[model samples]
Target chain A: MRDLVFRNLRGRPGKTGALVLLVTFLSLTLCGGGLVLSSLRAGLNSLENRLGADVIVMPSKAALKTDLDTLFLQGTIGPYYMNMSTVNKIGRTEGIGRMTTQVFLSSMRASCCSIPIQVIGFDPETDFTVQSWLAQSRQGTLKDGELLVGTKVNVNVGESIKLYNVSCPVAGRLAPTGTGLDTAVYCNLNTIRSLMAAAGALGGYSYINGDPAETISAVYIKAADGVNVDDIVNSINIHVRKVQAVRTRSMVTGVADSLGGVSRTVTVLMVVIWLLIWVILLVAFALLAGERKREFAALRVCGMSRARLSGLVFAEAFCVSAAGAVLGILLSLVLVRSFSSLIEGALGLPFLLPSSGTVAALATVSMLVCLLAGPIASAVSARKLSRVDTGLILREG
Target chain B: MDLKAQNISKRFYRKAGESNYFYAVRETDLELPSGALSVLMGRSGSGKTTLLSMLSGLLSPDTGTVTADGRDLYSMDDRKLSAFRAARISVMPQGRAVLDTLSAWENVFLNARIAGVRDESLVPRALELMERFGIPDLKEALPKELSGGELRRVMLCRSLLLSPEVLMCDEPTGDLDDQNTALVLDSLRDYAHQGHTVLLVTHEADAVSYADRLLQMDAGRISTPDPV
Candidate 1:
């Protein structure tokens, strides 16, 4: 019976169209679904991997906001100045193993291009997280006036790039991290302070005009091995006047939650899209089944078992869906890779390529959908065909 | 095994004004013995095909029992009945009931496979049947490519794939010319000679001449042979 169904499914002309349409539809939906899921997973994973410091001390006012408005939402950052004095104070605190400061110099273009790039200043010797990834690709230590470029950085190695009028050599390029780090340029804190001082920018150190300064914007703290991060943050909040301490885990959760609405919206939209595709395919199958009513009646009188007939219908649908799913997945991969930059430009958000797991899941779902659709449509048509009197038709013919 | 329809009756309702019920086949009793060829002859609207359908177990009578090989046809579950038909009985319905997508050989093997008799040997067997029927070249031809007579022959070959206990054919020779008609009758006669019950429904006298017994149907009842 299974063989019979398979044979009929392969032999039928109408099944070809159904298979093409169903597979095409399912494949497209699956691709979109895979992309969305993969990007979300990659984004979260990157966030987890890049969380180096156990605690971050920013401005208390900025920390209290639910939106992380000062750090991410608005272009304007509040007074989160935990300069040299604050770092020194925190370094001396008991249970503080290490501390480093980072100052975010607003987006600036290199001398080669006009496109703005995010510039971050860090202490190469003290900053462990982002620096380690950079150091792995570096042949040697970063010298004075040298910069480490992220994966997406526009500058080439050995290129002389200017940061606020101070020229620097591009030392090395970081690997793709699927995070904001990919778009950032890492330079020593001294270099940033010197550049800002020469430019006479706001919050710049006047002493950096002749020599490098130790002042910084924000401090990242790592608690001692046995010391709890929560305890350190609480103590810092109590003793440190204006600074804010954020735990690494809580910061990730906060960022994820801040974008919760977008995630939910994307999920809901994907469901709606899939539902719409199902309906469209259902209608198509229904019409196809209707068109083949006479043929179905003929088979019935010819002693074809209902089960075998149903199996044939299912096989036809499955074939169509499988084709569509493969095509859709391939289409999605091409679209995601080729149009990633376009998507980034349009949405002002990174577009991450989906992983193999996502592609496999999409294909499985598409195949199931295709396999299910044929029988449902065929059952409806078969019921109507069964109600027909075969003998009467024979006599009339 | 014999195909029997005992006191079978069927009535359908008329949607328009006056008539409430229309009897398609009423109080019809039939007995088709194994290893015999029987013909059911009737004009248009004479209920010959309906009675044949009831005998074949494809249709259930509203008030009577149809039994084949001592098994009640209407009483069996769908799966059981389907199995019974595929294994014990074969039906060649009205018109060219061949699947348009499958070649003649494929159609033959399809039935054989459904009946659980599929073997690689069935290919040569199918080709032999097609050749014997004078359509040897049609083994690889799809239904849409075949003539009406060719299609009927393919359906006949499919029905005989399992060497069923009973072969119920409705107008098997309706689309054939004189030469093909003779060929089909010879096939039916040969099948009956092999101890398979062959029940044929036809309006043409030439088609029924090969039958060992003849039953005339009119209105909704079969007229007794040598009618009083």
Candidate 2:
């Protein structure tokens, strides 16, 4: 039986090759779609956890000026300014639990810095979000002039980066959040004040008497337990002067909606292609069985049992499908890995590859589906061929 | 083993699920006993092939029963019957019976392989049969690479490879020249003389001369020639 299977596959080059190609197409679609969906789900789950704050109060015009979701996702708040008094006023609000102030500054693409990057200056005493993330990689408190780098910062710990003529040694690198935060840099408030002084001396500082201590960019707040987050957000927006309050869920909801649309389209496309492959296989096998009726009849006349005959057909199908699966999996992995950044940019969503085990599991599932496709599609024709009237087929010619 | 069909009849419907049908082989009794060649003669559409199919256990008759070696052929399950055929009977079908994927050598040994038996000892015998049929050099050649005459010989070699108790050939020499035709008919006669039951159907006059007994079929009915 093995001999016969191999002989058929080797002998019928055209049929075998065509079947393999079809299965490869199916596998490619399954794997590629699975990866994209998995990556998006992972990114969304991570995003939800990363956005620990309930409401962010930014300068009123900053909401109109910046893409808020992108800002939250990337860790880059615009260089918007509001009085430090705004943080105190928001802290005194009725339902505010814990709040932290962040100052936003931009690096110059001058002789001092190679690339322009967003510099986030977080206060050690009042901060909430960055501390937990920082603890995942290190234990020591962040000291002045020592920087924490994001995953995309490209500088290693202990490496010195020049910002506004002041050199800071990187203390640690944060884990990826699959957002613009990966590319941004973090520091203590004292470092930003020094950078601000350096900028003022360099004639680069233009804003408000160059005073870094009196202003803050945004205030991240967590509402009190059982308090209505929406009410807290509304209170801050109404009572707080010259600032806009934004809920973190809105950013998450926006991404969730986009992910929902993507999942629907991918699901539909996968189903349509599967149906098309099945129909094409059914027609192709029926025609192939028809063309080879006399040969099958010859096998039957040679005393090949119906069961054996059908087994032979399925064995051949398995060969074709398995070959196609290997090719499809390899091709799909390469395509997804290579184009992930492009896929992220195009989808306008945070993207990250799932773990190796997850990817391998997807491949195995896709392979099983591809393997079953050929046998399932070939079932009717195989039975028909096995049950053919030997004498009649010979007589037809 | 003897191959026989008792009062067998076969009808084929022109359309599925329709009452309109015609008999391809009418009610008749057929018995091919061992040790001699019995040839059935017929013209086109005369039903010789239909009767042969029922007797060879390839087709189920509409009525009556077919038996081989004292056991009802149709009564046995497909597995048992097919195994019986593989061990004791060989059927050489008419017209382009070679599996297109396999080489001539593989096709010769196809019956034994399909029967789940790997008789490596048949290698020498297979080559000998291929040599006798003048297709020895074409052993590695695919069916598409062979001529019609060569293809017929491949099927013939395959049928005789197992040296079963019963042998049935239908128009086995159709594509052959006169020399090859005589060669094939002589082979069939020799096969029968070896104490095997040989039942063949052909329109060739040369085939009738080589038969120990001649039978005639017309419009799905059989008649005897009582040929000397």
Candidate 3:
């Protein structure tokens, strides 16, 4: 039986190749869609955990769209500055538990620093989000003239990077967030202020304008336990002037909503393609079986049982589908791994990949979907072929 | 073992009227004895093939029964009948019986394998049959590579591998040249001489000289068997 099926497959290379190609297309879609969706979900989950803040207060003058990227990607779109007074006011709010401020300083294109990286300045003394993550590396604080590099940054920890004629030591490195943060560099508030003042002295890019040394880009605040996050957000928006308080959930939701549409479209496309493949296979196998009716009947006369003959047909489908699924999975993995950075940059969304175990689980599900497509499509035709009356077929011949 | 068909009949209906019936074979009684070659001859559409089909268990009669060694062929379910036929009878179907995908050797051995012939000499036996059919060198060749005469010989090789008690051939020499036709008839005669029943259906009267018994079919009716 095995020999027969293989011989038939080898004999009709064109038909087998077409089926393999179709199955491969299905597998690629399944794997690609599954990987993208899972990656997006992981990114959003990591974003929620990394924020660790209920309400974020940004300088009201900042463009809403750019501010959204600033909150999620740690990206600075132009210089948006609010007086240090806004952080103080938010800190004193009724439901505020802990509040910390971040200062954004852009690197000059020709500056001594390593290519125009987003320099995020955090208050290590009072920070909760990045500081907590840094605890995993057993790092306590970012001292003066020290930089913390994100995973995607070219600089390695213990290496020195020149920032505006001031050499800063790469003190620590953070794991990948699959967002703009991967390329961003981090430092304490004092370091960024020093860099700004040095740039000012050199008559270059400067964030400090005139007098007050205390300038902040955004205030990250955690609401007190059991307090309504939305209420805290609304209270800060109403009470704290010169700053707009946005709930982290709302920002994440905005990106999630867009991603949801994309994922849904992919899902619908997958289903549509699956049905199309099935219908095509059904028709194709039916025609194939019709053409081979005399051959099958002759086999029957030669003592090939109907059930075994049907099994032979199914076996052929399984072999082709399995091969196609494996090929498509490998190709999809290559495509996803290659374009992941571009995907993140284009979407400007926080993209975190799940662990390896989760990826394997997702791939398995996709492979199963692809593998089942062929046999299911050809089942009806195979059954009909098996039960064909040999006597009539022979007499007709 | 003897092949017996008793009071068998078959009818076809016109497409326009369900009540209208055309008898392809009617009230046919055939007893093909062991160790003899029985040839059924008639013009095209005169029910020779239909009667042969009934005898071969390929077609079920509208009435009466076919039995071998007192076991009713039609009474058994499809599976049992198929197995019985596969193990005990060799059927040489009309037209090409070789699959284009398989080599000549594989085609010849296929029936023996399906009939579960597990003898150690199976390969040699198949090769011997090929040699006997005068196409031993064509073993590795696919059906598409063979001529019509060679294809017919390959089919005979396949049927002969079963070593069945009953053998049925339908127009085995239809496309063969005179030499190939003589080769095929000689093989069938030898098979019948080996204590097996051989039934051959053809419109070619030239084959009558090779038969031990001749049966005539016309207009869905068969005459009594006459010794040739």
Candidate 4:
């Protein structure tokens, strides 16, 4: 069978062109779908892993869509103040394991490189998710007056950079995560408060001289091992007024659900494109089969069974599809890497370049589609060619 | 073994306006003995080619059976019949039916490969056949590049590649010069002398002068053979 396929493939004409088109289409779909789907999956996974806290209590006025958009899309920083007195109240509540406060601060800075950088301030000891990634870096931790920069930070180690009128040393650099982390800078919460204090913007600084308030923007609560996150969120929401506690699991699910409409749109568009391609391929192959009518008829007369003849057509398509897929994958990789920023800008979401697994899956799907299509088109052609009476023509000749 | 078609009949339907079915080949009986060259002579539009097609298992006879080596040709399914013909019989249809993409040698070897002969040595065999037919250097040439006579000889070589037990030729020497005609007839005689059954269908008398026997066809029925 392999020999038969090889011989038929070699004997087939117009194969190179067909192969090029097949691979082009497959590679584009695979690579495009891979990049988008993988990025979405990775982003959701990263968000889920990093939230660390089982439940987040925020102001009820904070809309879910607005908060998510601010956190992930616009990268906007929103501040909510609840008294530190509430922390003790939350700790004493049943089913609560541990609680830590976090203050969010962001600043856009243009350096010698001229690219704007977004800085984030958090408590190092309390921020478990950031700490985990930090531990993986060569320089393990961040110190007061020191900062951790992501892979795209573009600053040299130990470089002095001024943020909010304070010069801080770069302590460590993060690995490239192909996420928004690549564009972020991290510093301790104290440093952010100090900067705000110098600017007369710190809480209680105006009324109490330099005796700053120990208040935080948000508090993260970890649930007891046996506690259900959804139940905790519901319980907290019921007890606390004007505050909404969201579970990490529910947040991820909510985001995915919201993105469902976009996914559906993408899916419908992909299907329409695929159908168009199918029609085009059908016409192309039908004409190709028509042009080879004499050849197929001769093959029939030469004792090639209808099955084998159809197999030959399928084999040719398989070879073409395989070759096209390989070329498409290589092309897609280059395309994703080069155009990721454009895609991110267009979609208003983070885009990750496709991984090896993603590429393989795409190629496999493309090849399967091509293989299946070949036989269907060939069967249509084969039926017409096989039934042709060569007898009259042979006698005339 | 002898090739025989016993009272074979076939009727083809015309378009809706046509009142009757077209009788392609009706009650045609023919025979070709092993090591004998027999030609079915007829003009254009004659049912000679249709009869040969039925005999070769390319078409099923509506009312009779075709037998070779005492095995009924029409008894097997389409797949088995195709395999049987590919393995044991060779047909050189009118005109040069060589595959255009393959080289002369590859085209010939392809026939053998299709018949389940996969030896690399088939290359040499193809070359030898091409050399014997006086187109040795043309082995690597594409069929489109070959002249009419050269293409005809290549087709014959391809047919002979499997060393089929039965060799059927439909106008094997059509549109050829006297020299090319003699070349093809001589090759056919050589094939027949090697104990293979040979059946030739042609309109020209000179084309079948080398045949051991001759059969005439008129209106889809074969007359008794006139001894050569």
Best by DockQ: 2
What order do you get sorting by DockQ, best first?
2, 3, 4, 1
Per-candidate iRMSD? 2.6, 1.2, 1.4, 2.7
> For residues A199-260, what per-residue lDDT tens digits would candidate 2 score against the true structure?
77787757636377877887888988988999988888789888988888888898899899
Which regions in candidate 3 have their CA more than 4 angstroms from the true location? A64-66, A70-76, A111-113, A132-146, A151-162, A165-173, A210-213, A341-349, B12-21
Per-model tally of clashing residue pairs: 4, 2, 1, 1
> Mind giving the per-residue lDDT tens digits that candidate 1 earns over A24-73?
76566656655765665565566566657788777565554432323332
Note the Cα lDDT for every prediction shown: 0.69, 0.84, 0.81, 0.70
TM-score for chain B in model 4: 0.92
True contacts kept of 4: 0.49
Q: List the residue pairs that clash in candidate 2.
A: A74-A180, A74-A181
Please report, as a residue range, the 10-residue window in candidate 3 chain B with the lowest summed lDDT.
B12-21
* Reference-based lDDT, residue A55, model 2: 86
Better-scoring candidate (TM-score), 3 or 4: 3
lDDT of 4 by residue, A1-397 (tens): 4655565556664565674575567556655665566766665566565567777776565674456445554445464545556655665668887676665555434332223555566777667656777777755556677878877677877886665456778888875454566677777777766655643542323332332246555667888899876777777777777667777666667756645655677767767776676666666667877777667767777888877887777776667666666676677667777877676667655455545686677667766665666456456666665666655445434
lDDT (Cα, tens digit) per residue for candidate 4, span B96-171: 5767777777777666767778877767778788888788998789888988878878888889888889989888
Candidate 3 docking band: medium
Worst 10 residues of 4 chain A by lDDT: A202-211
Leading candidate by lDDT: 2
For residues B6-69, write the lDDT of model 3, one tens digit per residue: 9999887756467887998989888999999999898788887777777777778899999999
